[model samples]
Target: MARMLEISKLTIRNFFCLREFEISFQNRGLVLISGPNGSGKSSIYEAILWCLFNRTARQSRVDDVVNDIVKKDCQVIIDGYLNGKPLKVSRFRKHSVAGNDLVVVYDGENFKGSPSEIQLQLEKLVRADFNQFLLISSFIPERIRTFAAATPAQRLAILGGILDLHHFDMAYEYTRSRLKQYQVELASLEKEISVIERNLEGIKADIDYLERNKAKKKEEAEEEKHQLVLEKRRLIYRIKQVQKELERFQKGKAVDYEAEERKLKEERNELSSKLTQINGKLHSLRQQYHDLQQIEAKDYIGKPCPVCERPISKNLVHRLMQDHKRKMSVVSRQIKTAEEEKEEIENRINELQKRIEYLATEKLSQEKARIQYENELSNLRDKLSFVQNKIDSIEKDISTYDNLLKKRYKDLKKNRKEIDKLIEKQNELNHKIELYEIIKEMFGKKGIRFEYIRQVLQKLEEETQKILYVLSSSKLDLEIEVNNKEEIEIKVYRTGIKKRYEDCSSGEKHRIECALAFGLNRMARSFHLMSTNFLFLDELFDRALDVEGQEKVFEILQQMEREIETVFVVSHRPELQSQFSNVVVMRG
Candidate 1:
């Protein structure tokens, strides 16, 4: 929409060797202002900026900017139309012994009102002080070259200002600040993860130790169970042994006590019968001897001769007496034998009685011994039974202990397995975290990531290629590409063969710069929704062009003018001056 900018009038007083000067600009075409060095041609440009914005292009101070050619009281005026609207701006610089004083006026309105009102209106219109926008000279090819030679940050600033992308620059700075904050947060997260992982490792170690301790306890419990079983077995064996001894004692087969008592009683009874028979025989023999003593043998023999009186021969009487004497002797011997037999029988009976008494005493003792053995055997059997029961109970307790130990061991093994799985998972998470850190660091070192900058670079390249085609007169084709490292490189082609940008000539570089500028202009128009009614070309075709190159440049400019409303060119070259429809010359 800003199709025409015309300077209707400009007046300079005491400014840069131009004590008084006047200039006017054409509305729709190129206007050339040219002279030799120090011809006040540059001073005209300075006065135009000083009247509009009240500052110099060289960034000079206020006192120094007061022109040396002006008298003590001097002023400059600039009247123009921006977008067909009237604009009038003026500045006055008064010289004093102490310093120079400055005053400003805008659109016939004086800045003598409240300072608050002036600041508010100025901030609303420009967003910067009016003194900072002034220029004393045209920033042509030399200035562009100077800007290109500066650092990348300075170049970027200039490019940003030209493209009206200061907002984008500010946004980029904000993004960088946020990226730093993210990096700090990521560092904190990494530290926290490290601490957690360390603690996990420590917990794993503790689990391992606890598992080992559990295993030891289980082993000890198993040993105790085994010992208990062994003790129970020993108790069973002792009980069995005692039981066998008790059974043997109950049988009573080791002593033949009843048979010995029967034999002693039979011998005593036989001795008593023999003693009674001997006593009876001795009584009969004693009675026979007493009858013989009553017979009175001597007196009876003499009376037998007187009483008998029959056949009394001396031989017969003597034979009868002899018979009687034989009888008496027999009876006496019988009596003696009977008495001795009876005496022997009495002594045998006494001995047999003593033996019977001794046998009875021994039988009583054997009975008492049997009773004591039976009682002891009963007690032993009871003790053996009790021991056996204790062994059984111990065996059951040992079995229960074994079961518990096995269960505990199984649980411990399970816990150990789970711990191993956790350790493996923790290691995997740690590796993932490390990979993320590496990627984050790589992204941080570059200005921006591929995803964010790729589209912008692609658009730049396409636009640059289109401009290159226009500048090259369709004879040479060029393509601009950005490599993975984010460096911009150009590729050229002739006859459908590609060539590197560095391999091109100086003329090629000039062409490339023009194409790139045009590309930027096109981008601005597209972004701002501007009507392409005019194209402004400064001294871009001055340095690296021959006659043929200039002709080509003129051809392109002519083609653009035909398609658009107007084309303006400012140049000192005679060829360019002759190409224009109108010309105005300045002389000093």
Candidate 2:
């Protein structure tokens, strides 16, 4: 059997709409917290919510809770007893940051750890957060008004919260994420193994080629190098013979190729110097012409000519203009003539360069016989180097192929073992994937997600209908069930056909809301979520309710007291003040 919690006292200071407020709730039957509209009735429950959950029923920001009149630190103090043992929960703002606030909890008169730690203990004791507490212990009439207006997902989420099966949705999402991660890892491993297999294939081909040719290749290379050495010795003898004859011939047949090249270079340099001087003179004359033209264009009227520094009259301006134009024409012709000469000089220099190159080529032609003999000598040396390299390479291959193939075969064997292990792991992961797919189907569809939930819900439907029948004692029976799409549907079954919650009248909807709210409270109390006791109604009787609907709500309240320890009904109405046995009046 579970123990019931009894809250004895609550104190608030500078919380929203509450400044220096305190109230006590005894462990008994219905206790009404009655007041007018602005009498801080809602703040009473909000303070209790803040004490237990570190938040308010409205989910207001931390900064919004500090009463505008107080301008001071906010606090909520709740002292209670759990199964006759003393317990206290207090929360107060210490600094601006929301998480920086402090929460202290006491068990049997001893204070515990930090805010977060104390919150964990408090949650264990209460078994409900702020929203869950409201759903189970509190009545909010806006739910009936807004049910048809909420989106399908939002409606489903609301039903899920009441059903207390939202954790299954979170679990499904987590499992799917893990399955995706495993698949990614398997793909990466497969890619890595493929690269290893390719390397193994290349290594095997090299090993086979070296193994088939090693001994025979070594013998053939040694014989070939011996023959190459004999030919090299004969070529060396011939090279010395050719050099002796060539040196004797060069001593008598000399040509001065450098002196002729130097004369051609001197002629090219003189032409280049003349061309540079002409370009410089042409540039200077062109700039003077431009200066005079700018001076003439600006109307030069009663202004001094910029170039001559003389006072300008009409006649003087005309003369300056004609002079400038004549000078400009002369400079342009000079520039064109200079450009022509520069081209001629460039061509002459190119011709001289070609002539010098021709002389060099002629000298090279004269030494062709010597070059031919040297080339023959170089060819013999290269052939010797090639043969020697062939002999060395074959020896190295014989030694290295044995060591390399041994190492490669060892690596190949190791890779095969690793591949076997990966295959085993892959098989296990495949089995896991199959299980996860089934889980996805169960969690995603109505197959098992609703199957396990249906048992609890079917019993709940009977319980709700029983409570509704006891309240009205009429032929109308309520049905609450999840459809094939896993959506929660609420209906009334009075006639042969069924009617949805949306089609019901305002009063009938109010009655349904009462039944569902009481049933939820019933669920929470039975499951030890709402202290196994009383219910709290926040302005439910003040809504647009007819006399019959109000009577039905009172009946639900009567049921609350009989089923639990104590109940609270928060209302602003004056006529219903005498209905409750215990009442605590609130002041604005």
Candidate 3:
């Protein structure tokens, strides 16, 4: 019923006047925070505000937030719930620096960002800001007159903020910002679309041009390829012919001219040697014939007597002559035979010389013809290789053209797909721009936000009157008026007599402000859909309200225990402690 906000725990260290403090507010109600001056009674609630919004009731800077005596960094940790979800916040401020740090965990997630951003996130979850907390959920003596003392326009604005109407302003601005972003994106997409269109046109022209040249180049390559193929065939034929001619030249038994000449020269030398031996033998035989004719057996008989010193007989001489004649006849026949054999050998040697000369001439002519045929064959093969290389080059050119055509087609297809995607993105951006425009109008001040304020203004007036009556023991009634311009003026009535807020006594004014704050807190929870559950009255009982007035205020706040889980009453009065079921005491 109280929007489910609960501060279950608060821990403070070296913050403000308190050196170290911790308390649990779980299941607490109507708590009395009693302490002497500078005992940090108000600091308890200030710590909560500082943890939630990085602001305090006192007009102090960040450097002064740390305890003066401790001279240490200030830290505040708060564990709570927002809309029934767990919330934890830790705030820190260094004594020597002007920077304040914040960390938040909401619904089991650590809120991420800078200190300022985390503060905004916490404010968003609680549906309240520092001003709203001061005006609605808290009644600090220092800020008590802020709302009532403001001008009509300022008061209207302040009430609107307490009712959580600034969220509409943020939404309107965010929507307008989104709309501008979409418009810019759409413009950029249109430019992309235009560039893509031009590219597509260029691509089409390129494809057309390639297509025209493609056939012409292919035809030229085919013709050249055909001519090369024919040339290669002609070279092949010529090579085959030359090879056949070369084979014919090689088809002879290899001649060894040196061996033939050696054999002929050896045969001639042998025959000449035989002729000389025959001539020598013939001369010896002739010499023997001449000696036999010149000297008969008489000389041989005398020479034998001289050699042997023996007598020669007439009969022995006659017999020796007959033997010499027989020897001479055999020698003459051997001479004739040697002369005929020498003539035959000389004729064979002359025939061998003529054969060797003919062999030398034939070998020379054959070698020249073989060399000519080999040279012709080598030339034909080189021509054939050159023609084959030309054919291969032409084929490669044809393949290159085909690959180029394929790549061009791929480019054309890719460009077309890119154009389609751009068109789709353009449509999506246009629709988003249209939707954001409608949202912008809806979140404007005079739109749904205006209607909500109108209805809440009535409920706020009624609730304030109710609370004021209870707080004043039916002696005080409150009326809230709103002009056409949304300016507010609070009117108070005492027993049916109208009294101006400025004219009321201090006690009456405090009661009226308290009533108004309570009404706004209730309206914020119920009508504005904000989550809240705590109310802080810092020295509200000690300032101007008498004992009876304090009792009335306490009684009404006690009644609020059913809705608000925690209500902190900061006071130094000892008599007030007996009235509360829960008492938290702080000492300086």
Give the Å error, residue 52, model 2: 3.4
Candidate 1 yields a Cα-based lDDT of 0.56
* All models, RMSD in angstroms: 22.2, 31.9, 8.5
- List lDDT for all candidates, in order: 0.56, 0.70, 0.78
* Model 1 Cα lDDT, one tens digit per residue, 332-444: 88887877777777777677677767767876765676676566656655665665566566565656555655655565565556556655655655565565455554454
The count of residue-pair clashes in candidate 1 stands at 2
What pairs collide in candidate 2?
none
Best-matching candidate per lDDT: 3
User: For candidate 3, what is the lDDT?
Assistant: 0.78
Model 1 ranges off by over 4 Å? 1-8, 17-19, 40-68, 71-75, 82-85, 94-139, 146-158, 164-166, 172-467, 478-503, 522-538, 559-568, 574-576
Per-model TM values vs. the true structure: 0.42, 0.59, 0.60
lDDT of 3 by residue, 1-588 (tens): 334567788999889888889988876778888988888888888888788877787857877888998777789998888777888888888734534678788888998888878777777777666776665567665454777767878877877767666778889889999999999999999999999899888878877887777788889988998888888888888888878876765664224665676788788788778878877887888888787789766575545466667777667778777777778777777767766776777777678767867766766676676677678777877777777877777777777767777887898799889989989999999899988988887776567776677778788888888888877889988777776676777777889999878888888888887777677767766764455567777777756788788778877787788887778888889888888889988877
Model 2 ranges off by over 4 Å: 1-6, 13-21, 53-55, 58-74, 81-87, 93-101, 106-127, 148-152, 161-166, 214-399, 452-460, 500-503, 524-534, 540-555, 575-577
lDDT of 2 by residue, 506-555 (tens): 66666666666667566655653446344677877756577766776677
Off-target runs (Cα >4 Å) in candidate 3 are 1-56, 60-132, 140-145, 148-203, 255-354, 422-516, 527-588
